[model samples]
Target: MEKHSTLAQPDTLASAHRTFATEIAALQALDARLDDSFEQAVAMMLACQGRVVVTGIGKSGHIAKKIAATLASTGTPAFFMHGAEAIHGDLGMLTRQDIVLALSYSGAAHELLTVLSVVRRLGARLIALTGHAQSELARNADLHLDAHVAQEACPLNLAPTASTTAALVLGDALAVACLEARGFSREDFARSHPGGALGRRLLTRVRDVMRQGEALPIVHLDTPVADALVEMSTKGMGMTIVIDDNKQPAGIFTDGDLRRLIARHGDIRPLTVATGMTPGPKTIAPDALAVEAATVMDAGRLNQMLVVDDTGLLLGALHMHDLLAAKVI
Candidate 1:
């Protein structure tokens, strides 16, 4: 095969370092520029009776969409409307009760300006994120957030690198501030993100994953140790629960206990499960979060836990493997 010489590569690592430095400086400047306008913006969004509509174009539009998603997931109702699409017909998504968050690095994008005009006509509020304070969009907005940057990370100083980073961080700040103001809890966040790992950890209860009904390995206290071992093997839980007449867990016998019992005494054939079981094993409420169950099991170095009700009646059992299967671990 004919070979062609490759072009010499530039100092890519140095370029990346320079980009990081530039963006960090831009963020510091944006942080220092934060003032009453930011406070008012948060208050306005919190007071909004309708959704927050974020709109922008080009690179700014991507940032706007992310901001809208973050706000919606963090206890605020928000959505993105493309600037050009809004001018054509998507503006109907907005209502007088809604607040428009418009982004344009130059503060002079024509499509954003058109959306701004319609926003005013509809009696909706407008918040502008732009690099220029004196620009038309900034001047006309009900609130303006300055996302100015000294220079782009691009060596030519023309691309939207530093400016976009500043805008994105500013948007995150707004979302988090609103989230805190609304007192959004972990459960609330889990509700919005039901398909995510955090949702499984926060929203799933012990009852949702614990083994119950025929899957439980139950043996009476008077049962033979060999019988308890059979129940444990049949249930595949590595342990058997010793239950009383009231179906309350009296004790638990694990494989470890069986091993220790054998080591302590050579004659095991005459013993009942009571001689080898661990009494008053750790238990948790069925309604407790699965992650909480995991914490308790981890703290005690236990593999199995009994789920009970207020009256201490055994409802089910939870193996560490169950949490792993449910992805709550």
Candidate 2:
């Protein structure tokens, strides 16, 4: 285990405040320094027919990896190529159609310089993110993004603190600009991040989560209220879908409807499902997103919704519980 200093609370807080202030100032400076160069970089990325290969060494390498992931998830094809690894066998991954995004605070990492030389020889475009525009890496690049910082957030000003943050933010700006330029949508982003929560919500369809076939609670308008209740119980959806003679959804009978029916008529055995069913209930298409179903249910203050086809034929049923179980809520 590492030993920690028994520092006072106020001193620790003061140190944190100073670090935040310094980093904020650095970001403000970067924001003010944005120019047409940033737009040109975005244009290069948008026009590239191949992937964006981000390369860096040390702390910048970590930032580069994150930037690559952000770009990839946001509809841009990108991957990280470590600077040191590029000088080895990884340079083979680059193609003349691809663009190289190099990060180096000092703009003089030996590994990055070697990769830069290979990138130039292959006729690939280069975008350098560095603190010094006069450095070799920035000077040789087709476009240089000035990620200059007045000082590091570190108290000693020795670590790559503010500089790395600026580079990461600049890379993100480029990725977002490219994404908007390409008209990337939420569906596109979900396709790239299928394992994430947003992907589950955006990609999952009503058919994917709604109870269907035997699991669906369905009945006719003439079905007895008692039998409809049995179907609801068996399906565990707290509701039963009422269909017409043509097999189209007519309405829905839910637990709340049953309660209201009981309140209105003491002798419930005489009532048919049609008497208690809510006609013209809000419905969603089977191919619509599960999140859309959730939105409809929420807006109507309903606990259940019926899924139908384009012709209004009953396809399935969705309960709020189904949305919760599918983690789409």
Candidate 2 deviant stretches above 4 angstroms: 1-10, 224-226, 257-276
lDDT of 2 by residue, 1-329 (tens): 99998975568888889988988998899999999999999988888899999999999999999999999989889999999888889999999999999999999999999988999899999999999999999999999999999999887889989888899889889889989999999889888988889999989999999888898888999999989989989888888889889888888898989999999997899889999999998888999999999988898898988888888787888889999999987
Give all TM-scores, in the order shown: 0.89, 0.85
lDDT of 1 at 31: 89
State each model's C-alpha RMSD to the native. 2.6, 3.6
Residue pairs clashing, model 1: none
How does each model score on lDDT?
0.95, 0.91
